[model samples]
Target: MNLIKKSAIALCALAMVFTACSDDDNDDKNTLGDKEGILLVTFGSSFPDPQETFKNIDNAAKKRFAGETIKWGYTSDIIINKLRQGNGEGSLKGQIIDNDTPQEALEIMVKDGFSKFEVQSLHVIPGEEFDELKEAIHAFKEKYEGVSVKIGRPLLDSDADIKAVADILAVKFSEELKDGPVLLMGHGTPHAADAQYLKLQSELQKLNPNFFVGTVEGIGFDAGTTSIGGILAELDKLSPKATKVTITPLMSIAGDHANNDMNGNTGESELSEQSWKERLEGKGYTVNTVMKGLGDYNEINKIWMDHLEDAE
Candidate 1:
């Protein structure tokens, strides 16, 4: 009876040891920190060239953070819906992913078992979209107890960043400056963050007298210095000898606003009534519009990478 009891105890102990080993193996297989990735969130564009512009930014990020998997998200529901519905413009219909918001991208990463990752904004300013992105991250952080996440800043986060952007723009439009005034159009917001556009204008003006910035939203903080009207008035006061004005987007992608608001036609019968290009031409200044987003510049895109590297 004693031998039988000992034999039974030995078998039980062996079974317990095997079960512990199996559990350890399972834990190793399901380790929480085993994978990580990056998600680049932006306002999104359906325009063909700007779609490539986004790809360029993504490529730069992949090169900068070589090993990590990189993903993308668009903050605009209208754009995403258009892309998913196969109605996006040109060849870009196939390029844009279908996620409507950064939260969806985060949910996807979580679903894919990414235990850690970073969310980087491609926004030019820390305005409404960036604020919404932060809220999404906060919610995810609460829900995903074991997942680690970090966020990167927008392009114009600090005075130093703004100056850097100005320096790059100075280099980019060096030749154009000689011909005429270079006006950059930023998408303005009612949020106090619109101050960034004014600061950017100041920085660019400090770099070169001919450089200016204006907004489409007419929320320019200064008493009379942000709309196309305000900029034109200021130009009239300066009486620049240059006979031409070069216009370009200060936003990440030169999509709807850059195409229609800044360079579209101006007529009672036209769809766009008062474009910057038409308004400047009407003022007797020859207009030159550069329909390229800031992200199209490698130097400008590098600023985003620097921001990503700064994230902890």
Candidate 2:
């Protein structure tokens, strides 16, 4: 071939190679390094499934931040106790449950070296606990010179959250038990939590007439209002011969509260596995603890799909 023609072909080949190299470099720049992100935060799980609460939160995040990278972190001590694995040999089994206190969780995340953060809490409301979580996030963001963080609200406890929860749990009630009583256990606060309980009670009643939904809190319900004796007294008044009743927790995850406080027995309780089965059998109504978290399936899913798409 002629020298001029050969030179022209060589120039074109060089141009193609340059273009390919530039594309590769751009791909690397876009997908790797500080450009990638992770969302770190968790909700307060009430045990056995402390790990599961993070699992629910992580599932939601993965859906919300599909293309973007996200690493779930816990904010609850209840969960840390059940932790079995982490970023180690059996890393695949390593869930997000952690042994870190509020401050320690942040340190671990910083040590892993992330740059951008979108913190989402599974809090029921932007109440005291939620506020504390927010403070923690802000502190972390400020403490870490280069980290970016944003907070998300609790799904179930939104203005319409109680309503949504009522709808979700109404499915647990049977038609035959339309007149039977239903009690929902929630981690109620001493303050605004009463409002949440009222809201859920109202919503559940509207959804299904069978359940007169009421809440028992670590703070609110005592033997007078929520004390086991008071509740049993009312149950006797309503249905002395009633053969069955259904109880469920209104929290996102049914961990310790559902298992222990709601079901546990020191004197007389039915549902807690640690307690006597006879206590439940003696109750006459036949106690059953609902094993699902509010964020169990569909509710958790909506958060994930919606958020991930928005993040994209």
Candidate 3:
């Protein structure tokens, strides 16, 4: 080939390479420029299946708010430390890195120049954990005056939220409610805000007469109210001749409490302590434990998405 023709061909090839590199660089720049994001905050769970709860919520948020980024933060320090120290459960070992405390996650996001943050709490009630998350967001608002940080309400934050969640659970567990009473287990708190659970129970029972709510903590019971024990007592009265009971976690994720404390088989003799399943079975009731978190349900997840929209 002539020298001039060969030179022209080489120039065209170099130009093509340059154009490809330019397009790749622009793509990275565009991704970085989209700074608005959702910081999904949850009380981290060590259970492997519950890890998908975060992913599900994150995916929903991303779909609802397309073009926005998504990050995760856990409210528990112990879970964060456990995962960081490489001591989480076998299935969760490699899946817990993003499970840092909300503060750590927020700070990291800010450092990365994420200026617009929608902090969505995966907490069921507006209890201690939700309060702490709100406080963190407020602190961030003060410190980073230029950044925009808006807080999303917990699942049962308002009267509407309570009613909506009740309706969703009622439908999700309708089959069990048809056969036997359905009992939901929540991680109740000692905080005064534990009153949220009582309100939630009221709304749920209104939807299904046999639906009942209980807490791991006893803070939710009062004059006319019921604790877990109280709910169990009510169950006995409601079904004096009943032989079957259905139990499920009312929390966002069916983590340790759901898997072990509530449904651990008594046959695992090393962990021989009787769980809720054993306790109910001991009461002569055939217990059917459902290993599902509230977040596992799509309608329940949409409630959080709705809260995000309302907050926005």
Candidate 4:
């Protein structure tokens, strides 16, 4: 009887050893498993107000791409410097924002064992900034072997995107459109992609003739048609002569351009450099300014999210 008991005990020990070996193999497979990370790149702002929009975007991305490690990258060195300083008055007072550049964020992700990466740009157009981002992404790809990298296009990359954005804007400012014409201020670039603003303008006009799109830089390939002066000239040709106008920023964040350039006053004289608001008011048009950015709209954010999805 004692011999039989010893044999049963030895059999149980062998079974336990086999189960432990199987568990170790599975653990090793999981340790070297496929890992993915997402990097959201944008021309970041220095102000605190835009942080809310960023927060909303982060939340949306987290909800959509759950279980994936997410990170942020700011393209603007000036803004990043100011944020790091954290000693300026007003917006920058007592605020320390730590953000990584596109290259830095990707490096960190690679160090964390993420072999697959998806980069999403939050710019309104594929302008100079987006071009630079693409270059950076390309360099990153060349530097890392066996690492998969994909980048999403900007907000207005294709005809469908232009049409979709115009539709959303038309609906967003439906009430404002009823009151008067709406003038949107975009950040223009000398890049060939600047023509996107013109395309967007055409689409917006198709939806509503009162929609006018202009740029602050006024240095696009077709400057004559996309500049602020161009928009003012078109406004002059209005048959009924729009007496009231609603001015807003078409940028991702309503930063310096929206707050100061679009709505700020020089306060020196009417002859000095004038904001869009002042310029419109000079024409005897009652101007209503909306200090909201494109990022403030969930519908607009979804379009960006869709671009990321396509990239993935």
Q: What do the candidate models score in CA lDDT, each in turn?
A: 0.84, 0.56, 0.79, 0.83
Q: What ordering of candidates by TM-score runs from best to worst?
A: 1, 4, 3, 2
- TM-score for all models, in order of appearance: 0.86, 0.66, 0.83, 0.83
Best by TM-score: 1
Q: Model 4 over residues 57-163: C-alpha lDDT tens digits?
A: 88778888898888999999887777667632256433222467899888777767777889999999988999899899888776765678888889999999999
Poorest stretch of ten by lDDT in candidate 4: 88-97
* Residue 126 in model 4: lDDT: 89
RMSD per candidate (Å) reads 6.5, 11.5, 9.8, 10.0
For model 3, residues 1-312, the per-residue Cα lDDT tens digits are: 699999999999999999999987654333233377778888887668887777777778878989887888988988888877767666763353386777788778866867778888889888888878888887766666667788888899888888888888888889997778888888777776677777887888888888888776653356333455677677778744567889999889889888876787756476476667777887888988888888888898899998888774
How high is the lDDT of residue 130 in model 2?
A: 66
lDDT-superior candidate, 1 or 4: 1
Model 3, residue 100: distance off in Å is 2.1
Ranking by lDDT: 1, 4, 3, 2
The list of candidate 3 runs beyond 4 A from truth reads: 1-34, 93-97, 223-225, 265-273
Report RMSD for candidate 2: 11.5
* Best prediction by lDDT: 1
- Candidate 3, poorest ten consecutive residues by summed lDDT: 25-34
